[model samples]
Target: MTEKQFKKLKYYVIAITILFVVGFLLWEHLNGGILSHHLMHHSDYPSISNWWGLLILPFLAWLSTVRIEKRVTLQPDDAPVKAKILRVVLIGFFGMLVLSLVQSLSFSVGYESVAICLSLGLVVVGLFLPIYRAECIFGYVFGSIFFTGAIIPLIGILVIAGISWFSHVCIKPLVFRVIRAQPQ
Candidate 1:
């Protein structure tokens, strides 16, 4: 996509994110705050308002757009990569949203083991797809904010992102070097 098209897309994403958060807050208000209920009752997981999503999600949208824009500008010829990144971002957002909703709803119905597996599955996916840390982190936290709240998931994603980064940046190259040095 051209720079003009990318700019338009960025604005659209920001607008949609803001509108979604506003609509969610309104729905929560109308429902007497049912959406903001603490999904996990453990003492370690402090009760945080789903309203935090109002700020967090939009901020993530803006930040991701800016970061992607910088990357696209730096490699103007890499249109295929730009499109791939956009696809990954959209997939991550919707995929994680669906996963988080399923996990949260299942847990609410007492399927605690399913929820645990889903959460662990996310970590495993991150390990395997280490290059998409930013997209995954953004999507995971954005999807999680309503059901699981923001702070805890944000913390969890950060930890996962760190490990993914370490593996991607440090370990992967070392392994490649070792493999290349070995006899065929």
Candidate 2:
């Protein structure tokens, strides 16, 4: 590559790295206060065994956004769309199932488990799926848009939900087909 191209690439990579680093620092600082209260504070650092738990949130965020710039290109036109879609769906479904159970146990009286599962399913699916803008759309929004007549009568809400589901579910089949077409 030319020197100019190399320089530009370096600049962009550096900028992105710095952004993630600062984000990590900010997240860590906030989580530090919460952890200090729940686990141990800077004052209690001497008394605590390991205060590193405070870093977990920032670590997660860092992990999530490591290559955020490339999330779109993470999967390509030539990629295995079906497998990718299936994986995302399965994972999203499981997460939704758990979220449903939690919601049920919290609000309802006797049908806690059932309610929880249903609630979790809806919420988790919304969360796992991302829209064109890469936003997570939860069940309340999902059901409202896609299953409008059935449950979600609000079009605005359903629109966002549909986008999220579409993002998650839409690409998989395409990827799968492309992969299958490749010569062995």
lDDT of 1: 0.74
C-alpha RMSD of candidate 2: 15.0
Q: Write the per-residue lDDT of candidate 2 for residues 1-184, one digit (tens) a residue.
A: 3336535654664455446445544665576531222121135433321133223223322433333324424556544663564356445434533443344334335654675466445445454545312112222222222111112212333554565567578766677889999999
Best by lDDT: 1
Provide the lowest-lDDT 10-residue window in model 1. Answer: 34-43
User: Which residue pairs overlap in candidate 1's backbone?
Assistant: none
Q: Output the lDDT of residue 176, model 1.
A: 91
Residue-pair clashes, model 1? 0
Best by TM-score: 1
